[model samples]
Target chain A: MKLSREEVVHIAALARMSMSEAEIEKAREQLAVILENFEILKEVDTTNVPPTAQSINLQSVMREDIPGESLPAEKVLANAPDREGDLFKLRPVLE
Target chain B: MTDKYTDLTIHSAHELLKAKKLSSVELTRYYLDRIGKIDQAVRAVVTVTGDLALRQAEKADKLIAGGKDGPLTGVPVLIKDNMCIDGIRTTCSSKMLENFIPPYNATVVEKLNNAGAVIVGKANMDEFAMGSSTENSAFFTTHNPWDLSRVPGGSSGGSAAGVAACEAVYALGSDTGGSIRQPAGFCSVTGLKPTYGRVSRYGLVAFASSLDQIGPLTKDVLDSALVMNVISGQDPKDSTSVPETVPDFTKGLNGDLKGMKIGIPKEYFVEGMQPEVDAAVKEAIRKLEELGAKVEWGVSLPHTRHALAVYYIIAPSEASANLARYDGSKYGFSYQDTNNMWEGMEKTKQLGFGPEVKRRIMLGTYALSSGYYDAYYLKAQKVRTLIRREFNQAFEKYDALVTPTSPTIPFKIGEKADNPLQMYLSDICTLPVNIAGIPAISIPAGFAKNLPIGMQVIGKPFAEETIFKISYAYQQVTDWHKKTPKL
Candidate 1:
């Protein structure tokens, strides 16, 4: 199952990665090789088999919801590449 | 001067520190100097926190003086870059997190700090632990210490190589598939992947949440047990952390495997595997039998061949979701050469992630895409159940399973770089252990030429004691774990 260039580009878009034309060309071949590896799974009979999301069995562990100290905003924003005072700065979503 | 302490394990370092034979600062300096002098060739360490290590060493000296020393006190450790260390650069070897400094320490880091372990450096890895070799690191690839031309099996390559090169007493590595064990095998160190949820993942950078597990790569089986004793515990911060009481893994280190039952999975011995790996593991099995353990061969894991396919689907799907948080808006690198938030996110990730990471993200995006979710992702999860069941059935009759840690010895750099599938195949033997969520360890079994071949010992869920028992017995019968690479 080879991925067409358009399909690879569309998948990249959905993944929030912008690929250059060159990268799209490269992705076409690499993604095809990988997807072909997955094609072997179609031969397996998984009918009636239950899905395993987690290897270990555990219910959602809940704690008492109470107010506690959060990380200081300054510390949380320390790694932000673009930030205003106490706020993360981002490009406008819509023009 | 030859740094004699460089070859000391964490256990011996702690003993000497307690005896005042070696000061923590002096020991820490020895490692820092070794890394500075030798790491240029191996490229194992990404960031050397010398000042921080000295400060921590001073604290450890105080603890030892005050008779408050813990098991890891004064022992220098290299942490995989993906794990957070408060105020330290935890890059995950990705450009996106290149400048990321976590405000809080990961649970394991905090535990190590409390034990007075010295933080030496952050080791290089496959970018976000996505690849089988450290060649995927955006900054640089780590080379095997044994042969500088060859690649260090990776994601945990730096951690394993660091220990092998005597740059660190021990190191922590996370295994999503074979990241820890494969590297340990290639670099000729001992590594353990605790049962899934056995170690807290609170501060680890998420890769594939379900498959990701933190483990120790040490110079020997005993050091692995010693580190495991300190790191394995439940944490409230990680919801997936198991509540089972962590055992003293060292208690099972009597090296007695009398009457123990070990199964050898026939499926793991495929054609095209290195003849050396097959022979070394078989010899290790003979050694196990000589050590009084009953070795059973020809056990079949029928679904073992499907593990690579299932792992590619499940891991990427989870990684795609987990990595979505890396968009430029909040933390990490942001590309400003865009008009809007969406483009900013796209452009930042496009430039930030390496080629292998992008491939995985795209693969995951496609697998979990609207029309293909059921066909790919869901089906893979169901098959994951089948894979897990196979191990369960094997464990019913055997105390543990043994196999080669990797299919081949360390290959030359760029040998498998262009072929991603070939790189992925290096993990074929190790992936089934993770999918089964059982504890497994890779210990140096013997040498193939000069490179090391690793044998994996796998145990049932949360059965680390059993795995340790088998590994320790094997180590006792052989000196492979003691043969450090002459750098």
Candidate 2:
């Protein structure tokens, strides 16, 4: 259950977050404590239990096909920190 | 009139509205004035929608005058910022979304409005509902109205504090873990986390989808029931919303609970629990016994020790997936590029999300990644099932289970901030209900060292009516819910 510094770095990269060396060290220690505490699950017998993903046992409820009034383009873009004409602009992602 | 409205319960307010003694506009303005005067020091509301609320109040007043007054007509309600209110800024208390005004109303918001409730303002929360304390909010930490130096419990701290402070009649808060109940406990209010899928999650900015549920934080159990009646229903917009009939929640508030079997699990009285919290919970249990309910010490839920671990894994795993939609291009904050799309997402999310949020996303991504799903995510789900089965079996004999809502009383603001594991333990007793998808409520049980403590009443799935009945009965007998935090 021990989480290594490399594992923290790997998890951070997978999650698409940039972290500093200090954060990695802090995460490693914190994650280890959490993982160790989680080890108590090993004592429980879960052989016959079916995993419950949701509390309500209901299937998808779909709405009928219908058109509705949509917000104006300006209204939609009102909160954008950076935007172009009808589109949200962002920093380039490719190398 | 000011004091009358200030201390009035939702039931009393509804009566006043029907009798034409109080106009919705006046009630809304009263709250707005209160917020304007007191919130500068309390810091509960992130953004006050006074003008929009007045417009809604006018509409409610017209409805009341026209004899179409609903149960919640003229009731001014504060909503957590994470719940979407179309055209109102739904910041989730994060800098990235500080300016974001949702384009559409969340299903709950629409339902509340349709029920003739007026929106007071958006209350602050832990940024995207991440932390146990309001300190995580990027805007400002909402102070405990009772003790300004202490926190009011969090994620939904502002909602709980606002209701506690009488800034609003009732407030809606989403509980992912203990966000709703913990804050309610700290502020001495009634807060419920409905059965999963009971309330629509369409416009609630995703935190942990499976564990998240929107419910009410109110002054009393009756108001909680009334608010629950308005908000609980199926919606086609949310795929997971159940199509079951919304029960008349208030009808069963006076239902008899005599001879009901209440279970007290031994696991909840774990080591490290504050002596004050333990004493307060015991006192509440004794009161329940005095009300003619049969109490028994239950031995079920042996896997309770693993709840926090299981919750951390599963909640963060779902959170990672749910938060993936906020990549800056579609909504909220986006950084300007010197590179390409991948760099853009990295820069935006990196700069936008707080440290705790980033930590969870990373943990979740690892758990759900190709190789680790079985070991982490899938294993956690299996453990979750075991936990649910424990409750199911226990409920077959017990009418409801009782436990302390939190192990310790509300800690100082920065006490557990640096230690994530210590912070996670705050939800130990509360997380089982969320993981099991049962209806649970926290009511002010008593006080410890001048701070309020809460006792959690957990019931089987779809048993909110019974839970409320028990809670109402308890509130009627005890004055714990009436003990207000003096600001």
Candidate 3:
């Protein structure tokens, strides 16, 4: 399907990406070509075929819930772009 | 010794170390000097861990002195930047993770450390391994060592270029869809993409989890096997990892392919492929027959034409979900301080991700979005099953399938950068293997004009030994793997 400017804006919003009008225009054109290329898959007949999400044949593996090793809170928060005294600093989530 | 150490493979270098003729520090220094002098032109290395590598080399020397040795001990290797290294900056060649140093090592990094492999540096890649050329890297592009004017295929371009330039003995590269093999092909080196669950993905910044697998790009097929022996295994950290027993992959490098039923897929020899690439691969198949392997044509993979389409949809869909974690809240780059959280995230993503990455994320988000998921994403997944089934049935009649790793030799740097569809086509030959979660290797087949052509030997799932055996045999009679680019 050919993507419109409005659809591109909605996708960027869902992807948390902000784009300029020029970037959106470029994206709309490129994405339209890519999606059109995807039209080839529509030719295949997969009447009863189940969608394959995982490649290997395996069930959800359950491991022991006991904690073996955990990163310290300071270490866990080490790479945070913004941090408070002991918590991640974020823009106001609650008014 | 210093001059010779730079081109030595892991096995040959290990032999020297074990024979007490060389020290790991000397080998490390040799490679470091080469990288320092030549990597400027190649632009393959993102960050050179000189001090850490020297430190590791010193420790490896001590281990060798104590008579404790392994194949990779003291062998200098490059790590693709996406794999997290403790205290070392693990940028995915993007401004987003430019300074993001992980406090922990990836499981593969830990495994390499245990094997005593000297981690020389991190190699550049396409940002988030999204594009087919390193031009997508937010930092800089890695030029092909064969000819500086051409591109080293990516997103593992840096790894392949580094090895091709003799900057390191071998390097680890991830293959989501031909990332490792395509670059290896373009750079004229040996690269293997193991089965999906053959190697652990813990700490490999996920691109497409179902298709992503880490493998080696080496100077030769033996080095590929030597490195694979160290990296391939099940890890409790990666739940999708198969519980199959890990074998010594190097054990199959006996230069034997007698009675091996190798199939030459007719679908892979499609039109528009460079005639030389087609001829080189066909000649390589004849050479395999000379070694007593039955090379048959007419092995049909009807779904080959649609593998590329299925891959773009499925890979980006997974990438969209995986990359959502890159919000400004937790780590990496952030923007618009003192503003609302939503604005900060939007601005950060807009600024942090490169154009190709943003393109993929947008593509993925649209495919997975409501009202389109079933038509695009779900339909793609169903075609994915047909692609996988074709491989399964083909493998029933053949031990491995041989094809040209790429449709053409390496092109000019900016040749396909503007056309995203053309760039995606760079991976046409190698995508089906990843889609089917099977093992495949790209070995230097022969030269087309001045550049190298890579021939792929693809095997069944978890059958790396089969491909390795065939690749080793092919490399034995052929000297293409011995030819190095004069940088």
Candidate 4:
């Protein structure tokens, strides 16, 4: 259950977050205790259990295939942190 | 600035409004002014919608004048900050969404507006609904109304505190692993987490998607039902919202619990539970039996022990995926100083998210990572099926299950904040309900030293009416719901 500092950094990158050296140490300590708690689940026998899916026990719902009123581009971009006209301005993905 | 309308439930308020004894604007102002006067100390509200409330109230008065009003018409209510309010910022108590004003209303907001309920303001919560206390809110911690020193159990802390303080008639809260019920228990208000699909999730800021559901927090059980009547229904916008018949939640509330079978899950009453809370819950069970429900004690849901493990895994895994959208360029906060998008995204997340949120995302990333998936995420899902099956079997023999809503009464504000595991343990009693995706209601059962203890009434999937009926019946014989904090 204990994660190494490198492992914590890797997980942070996977989550699209960066951690300082201090945060990595903090995360390692907290996540180790939490992950160790996961050991309790190992005691439960689930030899033939099927995982619950996104579509739950309730009936699968489908709406009519038709167009409906939608938010305008301007409205949708109202909260954009970096915007140009209706488009969101962004840093280049490639340097 | 105090008025006669303070602490009025929706039912009484509706009666006065119907009799024209009070106008909607007056009632709205009463709440708005009260919130204005006392909210500084309570710290429950994130943003007070005084201007919008007045405008909505003015229109509601016209509806009442024309005799076209509904139960919730002109009733002022607070919404948990996670739910979208068009033009009003939906911060989710996270800096990431600190300035994010959704363009469209969440389905519940639309329903409330349609029912003529005046939006009073947004309530504070744990950032991204990640913690059991409002200490995690980037804005400020919402204090318990009963005692300013105690923590209001959270992520719906603000909503519960607001209702308990009479800041609003009722409020909406989203529950994922006890977010709604635990706080309701702490604050001595009634809160309900409906069947996962009973209420629409569209426009609600996603937490653990499968485990998350929006419900009501109110001064009484019936107020929860009144708000439920307005908010519950199938929405085409959210595919998970089920196509179930919406019942008039207020009807049959006074009906006796005769012949109804109630189960007491032994797993819920664990060691280390506060003596007062334990005694109060057991006493509440006796009260239910006195009301004619057959109580079956020692009913075992054996898989309950693994629920906390399963929840941490499943909830965070889903949240990790759900929260990936906060990339900074489109909406919400973005770190703009980076030369590259990758660094920009990373810096945005590192700076935008709070500790608990970051911890969850990392935990989820690790659980779902290639080598660990089977050992963590997949295994948790399989165990989730077992946990749910245990509830399914119990429901076959009982109409509902009764349990303590929280292990302890509201603790000191800084008591568990530093210890993450202890804070997480605050939700142990309430997590299994969200795991099983069933309906559960927490109502004030009793009190200890001026703080309230809540008892949870859990029901089968899509069985909101059954739980509501049981809760309302319990409320009839008890006056716990009648007690309010003398803040």
State which candidate has the highest DockQ.
Answer: 3
For candidate 2, the docking band is: medium
lDDT score, candidate 3, position A27: 90
Across residues B194-250, which tens digit of lDDT does each residue of candidate 2 receive?
988889999999998888999999999999988888898887788877877888888
Chain A TM-score vs. truth, each candidate? 0.87, 0.86, 0.89, 0.84
| B290-342: candidate 1 lDDT, tens digit per residue | 99999999999989989999999999999999999989888888888767778
TM-score result, candidate 3: 0.98
Clashing pairs in 1: none
Regions of model 1 farther than 4 Å from truth? none
Per-candidate TM vs. native? 0.99, 0.95, 0.98, 0.98
Worst 10 residues of 4 chain A by lDDT: A53-62
lDDT of 3 by residue, B394-457 (tens): 8899999999999999999999989999999989999988889999999999988889899999
Q: What is the lDDT of residue B204 in candidate 1?
A: 97
Better of 1 and 2 by TM-score: 1
Best by lDDT: 1
Which residue pairs come into collision in candidate 4? none
lDDT of 1 at B125: 99
Task: In angstroms, give how far residue B101 of model 3 lies from its true place.
Answer: 0.5
* Structure candidate 2, residue pairs in collision: A91-B337, A92-B340, A92-B341, A93-B340, A93-B341, A93-B342, A93-B343, A94-B340, A94-B341
What does candidate 2 score on TM?
0.95
Could you give me the TM-score of model 1 versus the true structure? 0.99
Q: How accurate is candidate 4 locally (lDDT)?
A: 0.90
Q: After superposition, how far is residue B339 of candidate 3 from its true place, in Å?
A: 1.7
